[model samples]
Each structure stands twice: as structure tokens, then as C-alpha cells.
Target: MIFLNVALKNIYMFQDAKLDLSYPRKLPSSTVENEWLEDFPKINFKRVLILSGANASGKTVFGKVLCIINNYIAGSSINQSTSWLDIKKVMFDKKKPTSFKVEFLTPKTAQAHKLAVIFDQDGLIEESYTCIDLQRNEPQSAMYKRLREFEPTSYYHKTKNNHDITNAGFTSVAVSQGKMKVPSMWNYRLCEVDNTSGSQGRITAHDTNIIKTFLSAFDSSITKVKSIAAESYKIEFSNGEHVLIDKGKLLDPDRLSRGTHEAIDIAMFYEAMKNESFGESATFYLDEMLAYSHTEAEQSILNLLIDTLPRHSQLFYSTHNYDILDMNLPVHSHVFLKKDKYSEFIQPEKMGYNQNDRSLLGYVKNDVFGTLPSMDAINNL
Candidate 1:
């Protein structure tokens, strides 16, 4: 099954995983509702913010909060879709009514909007609820019912579920259908280059062009993979042609490493984001942004996304690999999560750092953040 615009958009390697039962699922929905927002972190987010924390820290939880809020405002939701089953793996569940409240300022929407969602043991007890913190406004009210119904095809409203979006804004919500539909242009384009005899001539002329475009987003030269279908995927350039190796034979993608499977998947996902127009306002929350890349290629994948994705879109992703934090990224880009003595997932900000001195990587290295264990600790254990 395909999932559209539900999690992350554009980048393929960083897409969220579809739950297949083998993955450890979280508590039942009823237990999710008892938790409440103790407080909101006071931080000015960038066009892109990375919520980095320990294993159980609220990084994924914050991402869910944003997702629920966005889907509510855009009239596009994934509540009815099983594609979000992976979200259970990402979010923190206390087996109680859990509430999330966030005050955010979108680039277009200037008003301070308060959005909240409460998930209890009874199954999504509260969907995202929005509120406008206007001085003249009275008590909280439902915003979804008052929205302009911008996307009639959106499945969010089709479901009989009720979400609270009293203070939610326009750019805050979007919908995610279970399956994805690739645009005809991309399909035709890929097919055109499907079968040619030469290294470059075998596929459609656009084949190399597509690969070039895909690689241009990164800071490094194109990654050299022997075959898109193999474990040691390498690239060999000769006579103005790229050859993928399979069983020691110099051939095109039809014969290569298993990485080819990943390549095709990436190509399809990229087409979805490039062809779709969600206007300029969109935010994607991917549970794991590096699902297909090799350990060394993960950073390159992220760099490509950071380069190709338009500034209008915001992304939030989670990963167990400390390699993602290898570089000295900005402090604000991360939100360190750790379980406090109370066994609740809490952000480093809530734990009483100066905020200015709070470093997610540092907290993680020192083991002061999030409920989950650290990579070093995990490895050493």
C-alpha cells in the first residue's frame, strides 16, 4: 500500500516505514489519551527544525503534534488510513490520556495559534484541536467546522471522526491517503528510458538526466554504486556511460544490485513530491528519514533533501543511528528526549537547562535526555 503526503514528502530515503506487524507496536489507542501537555517549549523554530533526543524523548511526539495540527488545518488527514500504523512506533504513549499543545507562527499566518490533541485508551479520544489566541476572541471554539473546505477530495473530513482544531490555522493540517499515485509525467518519463542497449542509451535519455537531477541536490559528487540491486552498489564511469555491475557483467539497471529496488522506490517517491502542488505551505513528519540508505550514505541522503526540498516545506525525522548527529548541527535543531525519574518522556528544555546551553548531542552523550538509552550505552551494553 502507498501513503501520500502523510508522513514526509519529497525525499525517499527518509520516508516513514509502513508497519508490518513485525515492528514492535505501541500501547493501544485508549492508553494514549491520559497524557496531557505539562507545558510548551518556548523556542523560535527555523524553517526546518530537527528534534533530536534520546530514545524515548519527545522528538517523535512533537512531530506527531505538528502532523495532527497540520492535517486538521488543511482538511487533509490520515486518521482513517492504516499507513500511519507506524506512527504508533514513533510517538510516546503513557497508557493514559495524552495531550499535546503547541504555539506556533507559520510564515504566512501571523496569529499565535494553540493546537492540542488528546489520545486516550479508548482510541484517538481527541484529534487535533486548534485555537486562535486573539485578544478579542472569547473561549475556545472548533476551527475545522469553520474552515473553507479548501480540499474537497481530502479524506480527512470524509471519515466520521471528530478532531478539535479550535485555534488551528490554514497551513497547519494536510491529508495522507493510504496509497500513492505517481504522476503520469514521471511515469511516462521513466518508461521512456526503460530499455536501451548502451550503458546510457539502454534507458530513456532522461534516465541519466533524472539521476543527475537527483544527485545535484547533494554537496558531493554522485554516489558511485556498482549496481542499484547489490550490497556493494558502486558506479563505474567510462566512455561517457555509467555501468552497473551484476555477476561481474557490465550492464544497466536491468542487471545490478538490490539497491536497484531502493532506487526505483526513491524515484517514485520523488515524483510524488515534485509533481504535487500543496501550494507553498507544507510540513512532513517522517518517523525514520533514512529507511533505504546505507550507513555511510545516510548523511548524503539528508544533505540532498536539505538541498532539493523547497524552503516552504518543513521536516521532522527520528533515527536511532548516532551517525545522523555526527556533524555539529545547530543546537535549536534538536530536542533531547529522556524519561525523567517519573518515567515520563520529557524534553531537555523541560528538565531545566539554560535553553541557551542545552545541546541535544551533548545531553545524549552525557545520558541526561530522553527515556531511551543512548547509542554508546546501547552498543556497550
Candidate 2:
């Protein structure tokens, strides 16, 4: 599934915001070649998006929003009383209901699906899902809508299947009749590594190659990686040194640096994707992906993400690293989040800058995107 856009209201720092993943009508000349994935020969969509902002500017909150939406759509149970939290007393009203709307497309039919929900501290208030035929510019015959009124707690549902649903769970109704296919989605936060155990046996050449490719990108000294035990692995370096990872713990005379750990974690994830452990069409949220890496290593990992990621998947990563701003990514792929304000997409031409300039440092310094924080108060302190 490819996400087209998301709209949220009364969710944490977001009062009302929309994130659009679809490509804009105009193209930036300096955009990276083959930066977009083509759904059809004539229709293309962006696969990589970067979120940037100062500390506490809602970048991570935005990532969490995606996670919430993913969990809800995947039919994961949630606590209604505590799940819906208002921004604050000043910005929130007891009478207001939080809402979210998500728009996406399925690979099989290319139908545009819009799923929306309204809820409050008590429980779900209303929900609806509509599928639109993009080719014909009309909505499909199958649609699902639910409203809560007479019974305050129960919901009245209407669908093409004509099933009578009262007080039914939103996810249950949505997943019924095989109407919605839940996509594989994962959120990778800083330093969080998958610790699933690998059996102790002869490591296949394919596994060896995958490990080497990952380590070589950060440190060329690494020669081989083998599963030493369950949830553990041994790393062999060309310099006759060894390092052991036991259950995500690094055991070496000189402990592996955070950067190394980050690389290993990402490499293992990529290897899993290569092995088809993660099904096709997954969406990955990499929060502060470059937190532990230096400039050079960060660039290397970015290159790996661009080159090795499955063509059918999409990646949304947040970063404070300015070097990323210098990359040849398209202008539409950059999202700038502001504190207590609306997030927006950056258009280079609109800001009187050429796309090929590669002078993002200057842009931020001049407040072209308004994500940079004002340090004047710090000096006063």
C-alpha cells in the first residue's frame, strides 16, 4: 500500500495538520535521478521522505501519529480512556473530538482509500472508509460508514455487504469481508534493534554476504559475521580482532561504538527484508535514524537506504543532520515541523532558491523554512 496523505486534528502537538506524500505537479530539476517509484509507467510516487525540525518541534510526535494510525488499522486493541490525550488544557476543549483521516492506494486496484475516525476520551465517536476509483473519478460501490448517536456507546454501521453491525469495533468492521488489507509497517527508533534469535549453525554464504555488505559500509575492517548462539552473533575483523553480540549486548574489549551498533541494527533489518522476512510493501518509520552516526557514516547509511531498500516499500525518517538537506532529494520530500505551529513542505523555488544550490545551511540560517530555533533566549539565560 502507498500512502497518499494523512490529516490529524487534536493529536498532541498537532492542532490540525496534513502530510502529503504524493508528488507535486512541478518537478525540481535537481531532484535525485530515479528518486520516485513508478506505480505505472506514467504515474510515479515518492518513496523516501525526510522530517526535520529543532528539538521538541513535533518531529517524533508526528512519527508516533503514524504508529497510532498503523496500530488502529491493524486491529490492535487500544485503551480508549488513556489512548486519546489532548495537547493541553489551554489548547483542548472537553467538547471537542479528536479526529484523523488517512488516504492511501492499494497495488492491486490502484483505488484511493480514505479512512477517517473521530473519537474522544470516552471512546470512538464516528468512523468511515471510502474507496475511490481513480481512473473513473468515482467512488467504488463498496463503502463502510459508522456513527454513534442514539446509544452514545454503540455505533450504527452501513456497508455494501448489508451486514447489521451494532456497537462493533471499527477495526473488526474494517477488516471484515476482507475489505482492508493491512500493510506491514514498522517504526525503528534510535538504538532500538531487533533481537530475534538466530539459530547456531553454519551461516550461509548469503547471510555472510549480507553481513559483510552492512559492516563494510561503516568499517571495512570487518570480515565476517556468524551466529554464535541464539540472539547472539560474533564479528570477525580483518585485524585479527573479534567482537561478540549477546542478546543485543556488545561484548568486546573495546565496546562497539553507538555508530557501529546503529549500523548493525539497520543492516540486520535490511538483510531480513532481502530474505523476504518482511513482506512486500512495508512502511518504515526511522526516528532520528542518524542520531549516533558521524557525517561520513550517516551519508553512507543514507546511501544504503536509497540503494538497498525494497523498491515497493516506503521510508519516512527524521533527522537533525544538515548534511541530509544537501542531498539531491526532491523539494517535496522535505517536511519541516515547527513547534506549536503547522508543519509544511519546502518548495525551493518559492523561497527564491535554486534546487541545485545545495546551500541548505544558508537556507536554515536565513529562516527559509522556519524550522530553526531562535537562540536569543539562551543568551539571556
Candidate 3:
């Protein structure tokens, strides 16, 4: 399933925060629709999302919340797991039920669904699911209009307890067997500061090559990456510097730079995509993992990912790299997060910056979008 829109409510510090993946209609779409699914020819929803924001603007929080919601949709976890308590003392402090509205597409089923969920500390209290009768070659706007016109009786309200409301998504053999929601192919990776690089998942010859090329771009001192074992890796530096991973744990981690470490984590994500290369649909989110890499290398990686991903997939990338704005990409691909009372996803194209002639980087640098970091504290210090 592909996420089109999502909203969070009643969660502490995250009330009514909406994330939209829809491409702005007013902007001229790419002649080559790499970011759209062929199943919905008239509806060109975004397939690549470049998320940028100031520090403390909730980039990691966005990925974390989406991960939980993905789990909720897949029936892997529900009822707002206690694990969220560690996020913040303020989280879940309110008496109100944590609620969400999710709009997604299950293209294999040839239908789109809108989900409404309300859950308390215990379990799910109320939830509703509505599906649009997808017509062949119908545009998203038209389909939504038809959904609105459809009778209310078609809506599928959850009948059971929260945990059991698992049967909420596409009803397939997987759902019948109590495995998971159908088409559950998604990945979420946190940055090095927020998550440990666990054994750099699914190492392979492909990942090793990609890792070597990527690491070399950032640090030319790195010469080679070779597999030492099923999970171990040997990194050889030209200056005779070496780093070893024995069964996925870095030995003498200080010998490894933060940039190289995150590259390994990113290679893991690549490994994931490689495994799913043949799959129909997938979703991947990487949060600020490219912090140490140069914008040039980021552009290369972004291009490679765009080429590598399946046609029916979307990748959400979060970073503070403004250099990316200089690249010739659609303004709709970007969502800038700024926080006051809560976070807001600002779409430049949606905000009337339609033409590609203007300088996105300049606008951002000049604080036109108001996403530039405030230097007040550091200046005062």
C-alpha cells in the first residue's frame, strides 16, 4: 500500500499534524512519471518525498510516528505501544484517545482506502474504513469525489476489539491466515544519533560494492569493503587504517568515522531494496542518515535509489541538506517542517511557488519558507 495522506491527533506534542504525499495539481508534472504508479494513470501521486526541516523540527518524530502507523495498518502492533512512552514524558499524558486518519492505496486490490482510528491506553475504541470504488483510468480527484458521493452504508466500521480490528486492510489470503496486512513492504531507518546501526542489515556482495563506492565519495581514505563472515565485514583504508565488524558489531568503533558508519546503515537499506527489487510495491524512509555525506554524493545516491526502486514505490528522505534544492527536481517533492505549537509539512508548490524558474535554495536560504534554523541561542552564547 502507498500512503497518500496521514494525520495524527491526541498524541502529545503531535496534534493534527498532517503529512501529505500527493503531488500538487497546479504544478506541471514531469514528462517522465517516475514518481507515479501506472495503475492510476490519471492520478500521479508523489513517489519521492524529500523532507527537510530545522533541527528539533520533528524529522525523526515523523518517521517514528509513521512507523507505528504502518505497524498498526499491518496488524503487527496496535493500541499505541508502551514503547512510545520513552519518546517523551509528555506523550500520551492526555486523557483523550490517540486518533489518526490514513489514506492509502492497495493497487493489487485495485482500491483505495481511508481509515479513521481512535485508541486509548488500553485498546482501540472506534475506527472506520472507507474504500473508493476505483474505476479504470480514473483520476484521484474524480475517485475521491465519487467516494464522497457513495452511500454511507458501504463504509466498513471495525466491529471487534482494537487488537482484532487487524482485519481492517486488504482482505487477502495473508489476512485470512492471520499473517499481516496484504502488501506489507515498507522500511523505516532512523539516523545514527537516534538508532544503533544493527549489524547493517542483510549484507551482500551488492551492498559491499555500493558501500565502497558511497564511502569513497565521502572519504577517499577508504579503499575496500569485504565480507569477513556472514555478518562481519573488513574495511581497509589506503593509509593502512582498518575497521572490522565481527558479527555486525563494530570493533574499535572510534576508528570508524560517523559518516562511514551511517553509510553502512544506508547500505543496509539498499540491501533491503535489492531484496525487494522484484516486488510490486514498497515504502522506504531514511531519516537524516546522510548528515555527514556531501550533497554531491547525496544526489548520486538519490538518483541510484530512484532507478533502483520498483515503479510502485515511494521513498521518504529526511535531511538538512539544502544543496539538494539546487538540483533540478519538482518543488512538490519537498516538504519543509517548521514547529511552533506543532509541526507543519509545507509544500512549496502547494504554497504557490509553481514555476521551476525560481531558486528553491535561495528562497530557503533567504528564509522565504521560514525553515531556516534560528541562531538566537548560539549567537547569545
Among all candidates shown, the one with the greatest TM-score: 3
Candidate 2 C-alpha lDDT tens digits along 1-381: 667678888776677777767653436463444433344433345577777888877777776667667666666534433443122231234568777888766555655567777665544556666664444322222211211112122122433332555344434356554555556345344323232211221122235566667676667788888887765778888888789877656777365566676776666555554545444565666777568788877766776676655666667778889888877676666777777464444435345564645656677767877778878899899
Which 10 successive residues of model 1 have the least lDDT summed? 183-192
TM-score to true structure, per model:
0.46, 0.76, 0.84
TM-score of 1: 0.46
Instruction: Give lDDT: candidate 2, residue 101.
Output: 83
The digit string of per-residue lDDT tens for model 1 on 39-69 reads 2122123333344545444444445444443
| Candidate 2 wrongly placed segments (more than 4 Å) | 26-44, 80-95, 136-172, 176-178, 190-208, 216-223, 237-241, 248-254, 273-277, 341-359
RMSD list, candidates in order: 14.1, 6.7, 4.4
177-260: candidate 3 lDDT, tens digit per residue: 343344556777776433321122333445578768766766789899988777677888998878887775678777767777
Query: All candidates' lDDT scores?
Result: 0.35, 0.60, 0.67
Q: What is the Cα-based TM-score of model 3?
A: 0.84
**Which residue window of length 10 is worst by lDDT in model 2?**
143-152
Ranking by lDDT: 3, 2, 1
